[model samples]
Target: MALTSIKTSGDKIEIVNQLLLPHTTEFIEIDTIEQAHDAIKSMKIRGAPAIASLAALTVASHLSRALQADPAPEWLSSPQLLDPYITAQLDFLYTARPTAVNLGAATRRLKHTLRTGVEQGKDASAIAQDLIQEGREIDAEDVSRNKRMSKWGGEWLIEQVKAKGKSPESLNVMTVCNTGSLATSGYGTALGLITYLHETRKLSRAFFTQSTPYHQGSRLTALELLTLKIPATMLCDSMVGSLFQHNDIHAVVVGADRIARNGDTANKVGTYNAAVLASRHNIPFIVVAPVSTVDLDIADGTAIPIEQRPALEARLVRGAVYPFTLNAQGVKEQATVMVTPEDLEGVYNPSFDVTPAELISAIVTEKGVAVKADGASGFDLSSIV
Candidate 1:
């Protein structure tokens, strides 16, 4: 069975608690916009695309219930009353996570819908319905477009290999973090490209980093590849350089949290390290993501916000106790153990890092692949976005 991060039934949304993943499968219901915001802020529901989907769905669910209320809420009385209420909700949701541009894009898109409906002179109820549809579409469109970008990236990589006078079959690809079924609404971004290669029988093996602190790659990506029955190898984040130095890695594929207009990509922390090493090793580095991740307003990576997680998060690791400790519920007991000294004062834990456009071989979106022009340091992503 495929692993899912977000699941929806009618207006109710539930997400798999990612913190307890690979051991426990807990589905927490998101009943309100506040709950959705909290989930994203706390990292219970994460990944740029998945959190964006949740935020948009929460808005749709909120408006849906408002319409069905026995006596409609005061905010729904008219467009004048509705406009500020919905706008405020979206603004608050955007504050939950500052680094991922996808969340901001989703909110901005909804705000546009609201403004367009009002300008068209639609009544409150009609405008509410339009907003609801648009919100749902934001989530619904993710999966299909992910598959499209995956195909584009995968085929491009194969052709690049073939052009170099190498057999395209049995290519070994390395990836960072956890872009898989559990990261987005469906397929994925980088992991989707890896899956595409495997599906087309062009893959030999997939290598992934442990991605410390959160260990999303070890905990989430590992489980995902195992479920899909793909041949994979897990390496410590520190080993990316060694892996690249010794292995015939065809490419390093990663997903973007935010992609600047110059093609600079902010992704999980270790992604930059992999990109650097891949460049030294002459391996292609690919960034796969949806169009929503592209932030054209951000001229360069320096303008991109990097989220800092709690220092305590870096001091501890959560997992099932080895040697098989079982809890009363018959499941393996999971605990958070402090890996660093109790009095540890400093822990630099930034959630993501940016890879310069010069290090990137290609940036693939649902629209198409964008590459740097001859003698260019960055990509002109305006056309692709």
Candidate 2:
């Protein structure tokens, strides 16, 4: 619903390249499926939902161009030849990022289009047309869903504050990791909730954790909130407890990587730490994500597969040159600097950490808000999902 991440000019698609982000704003054109796969694999573009949207959009762009090519591809000439080709491409894109369930969902939607067209005995040309429309819809639907969830979560937070005999206006909220324009199709999830509060004149400030190792909070989330002119502050990953001690944070909001059937949430590695600290401080801990993030198959957090990033990634930092050094083109020179000792031993780098349902005060999706039963340690998410 928002034109933040995906920019389109006729048939072309370009995404803000995420690998060279924070210090530099470079938008790379993604005209082919291969480029989409490479961008996701190399981390040139990331954040589960965003990556999936790009993958789906890439296919749409490719098909759009193919339909308008100098000569239609032979596959488009016949129904039998085109089905397998499209199926293979969707499957390939699905593998780009394994941890984000959204990618899988996007691929599955595309596959459904393919199957329905075939089972209905549509010609190859008609099937291609349907797929191109479906692909773009996959990306388009994300933003609207994000907006709905943001409204649900944001309003719920305000009501919770008022019910507790506190002023609903001027609420201060803390969020972990990036859940903004750069992380989703648009508006964002948890960050969207924060933005909603700001827009409604009920927010005082938004405090975000640095979300160490990846620094999605410091680098990406900070840049996004600033762009939207939302009042916000950034704190290091280690300062969650300290922030709670001094700040009047109304709640701690976060985005989910995956949600198990029992309400266990898997999110950025530092999210569990924040949830633990929020519980200790008697603050409401909220999870905001699309219903697609709910994994009914997973019985609990233990069953959710956590992706472990390469050890080297935990020891390096990449940024533009500091101290006001300018490049030949008058731009800052960017470089990757290793932050760890020359020879370091074992590094524990998990892309996500599971937050038990007990620590979470509420789970907000587009459907509705789900809270744990009175004095319950876990939640039954079946009805909600």
Candidate 3:
């Protein structure tokens, strides 16, 4: 299905503003490196891969514009000047989201292109042209890989269900956080798997957690699923146990923020809680992310750096006014409300939590699915990486 994120107009590119989502559907034009960096840092545009793609595409757009200018830019006339200028821009965008490796990978790829072009003794304009095409490829590749991983994960789940003697057509799956269209350039990771099942007529229903603090599931995932016309139900972060007790859920799929070599996963903060519950119920727990999210440098979850969000975010809730006042465009106007008492203290808001490998049932990437070794508690992702 065509997603709202990848809207191409002849040669122009724009992305939906995720910060104002659900309540507002604003498509912001991304024409410069500064805009891409700001969108990522401000959470106006997010999802690790999606942000990376935007950053790369912005660089491509800038160069494409430069190439077509009547007199051509001065920077394009000198190889030495052009190299530093492009390197600085990519590095600046890299700082916007230091945690996600994909963003760094994208920047590094561009840097490599620049250095290689220079070493090859190419002229300034030739190097600029090479960098531009490479940048566009970086953005275009993500959606294709995402679609591949989604299909792989989806098919595996169906086969697993059938092995249990259950009809794959009636399989119900649960997921945590938002891994739908908004979470990527398109398709998504784990959510993309759910979408694939629905598209092929093998899914019974899709259940998602509210993914609290951020509420990515409630706000972003819900919107994406609804837009696709997929049959889905929303649950609060605390309700995973309740849902498991009553529903015949076949699997639990989640998007990963980072994965250690031993399969310990750092995903949205409440994910470990859900993984624990899923394990108790003997339900399969799947972690879906690009290979870039796997950090071989981090031997285990303890070594992974978990980001702590501001206390204010944990205290406030933003959404459309409950009664819903329509704007001039007939869309609801949203408001922010403090969910906690004034001056609430001791709020713990780590952006993600680590799920030990022992609890994870499988790990899926664009490359392929990695399952735990027989009788082993964790995975050795060295080959995959």
Local distance difference test, per candidate? 0.94, 0.86, 0.85
Q: After superposing candidate 2, which stretches have Cα over 4 Å from the reference? A: 1-3, 382-384
Q: TM-score of model 1 relative to the true fold?
A: 0.99
Candidate 2: tens digits of C-alpha lDDT, residues 59-96 = 88888888888788987877678888888898898777
TM-scores across all candidates?
0.99, 0.95, 0.93
Candidate 1: what lDDT?
Answer: 0.94
Q: Pick the candidate with the highest lDDT.
A: 1
**Tens digits of per-residue lDDT for model 1 on 121-177?**
999999999999999999999999999999999999999999999999999999999
Q: Please give the ranking of all candidate structures by lDDT, highest first, separated by commas.
A: 1, 2, 3
For model 2, name the residue pairs that clash: none
Select the stronger candidate by lDDT from 1 and 3. 1
Residue 318 displacement in candidate 3 (angstroms): 1.5
Rank ordering of all candidates by TM-score, starting from the highest = 1, 2, 3
* Candidate achieving higher lDDT, 2 or 3: 2
Ranking 1 against 3 by TM-score, winner:
1
Q: Candidate 3 — which residues are off by over 4 angstroms?
A: 69-74
